[model samples]
Target: MAKTSKNKRTFKRKLINKYRLVILNEDTFEEKLTFKLTRLNVFIFGSLFSILLIVGTIFFIAFTPVKEYIPGYSSSKLNKKAADLVYKSDSLQQIVNVNTIYINQIKELLTGKIPEVIFDRDSILQTFHVDRDSVNLEPSNQDLEFRQQVEAVDRYSIFSEATKSADVVFFSPVKGTLTDGYDSQKRHYAVDIAVEVNTPVKSVADGTVIFAEWTAQTGHVIIVKHAGGYTSIYKHNTALHKQQGDLVKSGEVIASAGDTGELSTGPHLHFELWNEGYPVNPTNYIDFE
Candidate 1:
């Protein structure tokens, strides 16, 4: 009975040893000991791996350069060049004064009474809203004398008779009553609809929104360029409703009224209409009365 008991104990011991794990020796070609890896060790290794991945990604973005797209950044550069081409550097007021004086002096001495540039005069008055008062000088100084010369040369600016017509309309240019007739006097070529500040303004014609910008003189201004070479200008806006490149229909609300320019006495709309590249009396075109 003692021998049998000892044999049974020996058998159990051998079975236990057979199932024990052995880590094979890498270099010594003998059995090697091993430690059981705990869960904490595995968690630390995973955390370090994740941190390294995130840091590498951040470095790639911060150190590398990239490009961006922005609008109107080049407007200043391009506009300067365009302005130079479109107009002379001299002041329009100075040139007008000098030319006016020169023309009057020459007209007095001429025998033919100086053939009046009637068609040219009509066209110039038609285009820029030039009035006789605009060219008329006070007759006191050298600057005043020069206006006559400017008016004389202005004869060459008549429309080429080939300009195509572009239609126009108005929501409201100003809030005041039509105080003065659109005559050849005040040189107020554009229509003035006088209104208190904060009056809502809208588009007069169906067109593409070409400009919605702020200026030092005009304040918040919007310009819509329509087909047929026609461009409508809305100046002295209190706020703008639409942005550039928006397609707008006639009578669409575009801005609110305000006094924006150096020429403005009160809140008003200095609304100008162009027909095939020329400024015509807006009164002749649209029925805003």
Candidate 2:
């Protein structure tokens, strides 16, 4: 009975053991049924390894030299840079309007109508007045005023008052020291007789007073459009002796000379003779007699 009691107690103790019993397979030396790891452990390890792989791939992509990997970033950046340079260059000229004129022949230059260069630029700067380099365009020869004046010469005929007989005796326009000879510097296309104020101005020939008005450099000027396409101009006058559309005989008291407007250089007469429309040397006609 005591032995039976001892066996029963031993069986109960075995059932109460904390460690699990292992069954070893004789063929493989490994346990057939053993307490190893839980399914939860496997899930944790797999998740950690996956996170590490994703992090490594992201780092490689960011540092790689492949430009196409990122969307339109590189192309957009390049276009922006080019645009900035263009903007900067345009700002320097500060151009308002741009006129571009084109001329065919240089011989026809400045004689034809002033060619319109659509790119007429109006600048904000005062020092940037109308100059060759400052103007942002080219124009045809016919477009200029000077050229038109030159061409107009051939279109008209001057009225010759006499073949030999003279109705009125023509006289010199002014009594002054000749500083600039006739047609010198091309600026003084006429003879500049340096005289004092209100000097006795005379007409070179018998004609009429047509245009008596004030101009920029010519001051209170008188333009006598002659019988022929010939015209005579007396510039830099302080006063007018004749009115517009008035008739006067040769050697008549038409105008007195003074330094007015752009004629302020010591009170002189800027007298010009135009044949057809071109300025001819007055010395050619002025008998040095």
Candidate 3:
């Protein structure tokens, strides 16, 4: 107990012990500056200075742009850019899905894979108990007014004009005997016209050529997109004169007839007419004989 108490007293004396620091002029031996300091005082001032330096460093990193350079830190601008990229990726995925579906539909149209179902309209009307005598043929005042309004709007607006199947004028693609007519029961959606090799095939209507490419099954094939949702396809061609995106007038030459495909039996033109994605008989529109 005595030794411990004596050690504490010595430590306290050393901490409180004062020392004189003096700066002197060498030649004159004159004291220019002096300071009376203790060990405890030096330690307290050094500790306070260290604490202030640490606090200042922390504030500089937290509030300034320097924090972005440090590891494990992200900037607000970087976060925004990352979010934008994520949204763009999602949008691109949706566009890709839509394109895939569209391509599949085009494949079905080209391969004649669309299913055809025939239903009896007379039987359906009888089952529904629809009587022609009970139905009124006259239009009400409101219906007449709406029809007049629609007619007035369609007269001035060319884009709003309704296209009737009868209004379309189809030009004959070639002068040849029809070898095979469109048979939905046999899944034959096109008409095969027998013609000589290298005979020029004309467009049925004014339109833009949408597809012109070679295929294994159809050989050189060309498709035209006409106004009023009309699409025309020509296959088993020797060559396509008008490329894709080319505009063609009615009866303009677009391709040459040939037996170039695996399915071709002889030199002929396989012509197809589609309205709003449904195949229609070419004989109904244009005469090939």
- Strongest candidate by TM-score: 3
Question: What are the lDDT figures for the candidates, one per model?
Answer: 0.69, 0.68, 0.87
Model 2 TM-score relative to the real fold: 0.41
lDDT of 2 by residue, 1-289 (tens): 9999999988766555456558898898788887644444556678999999999888876666554457854655677999999998786545432222122322245576546333222332433455777665766665687777888795325333224323333467766677666643444567778787888777777777889987887789898866556678888888898889888766777888888885467778888877666666666566422
Instruction: Put the candidates in lDDT order, highest first.
Output: 3, 1, 2
Rank candidates by TM-score, best first.
Answer: 3, 1, 2
lDDT of 1: 0.69
Model 1 per-residue lDDT tens digits across residues 1-289? 9999999988766544423347887788687775544445556778999999999877865555421123423445567897986676546765675567566656764657656444333344345455786685657677766887787686435533324453344444444665444433455556777777888787777889989999988789899987667778888888888999999898888899888767667877778776666666666656656
Per-residue lDDT, model 3, residue 30, is: 100
Residue 34 displacement in candidate 3 (angstroms): 99
Candidate 2: list runs displaced more than 4 Å.
Answer: 1-169, 287-289
Give the Cα error of residue 94 in candidate 3, in Å: 27
Best by lDDT: 3
lDDT of 3 by residue, 1-289 (tens): 9999999999999999999999999999899999999999999999999999999999999999999999999998999999999999987876666666656656776688965334333434345455899899999999999999888783322222123555668999999999999886676888999999999999999999999999999899999999889899999999999899999999999999999989999999999988777777788888998
Q: What is the lDDT of residue 270 in candidate 1?
A: 76
Which regions of candidate 1 deviate over 4 angstroms? Answer: 1-156, 159-176, 180-187
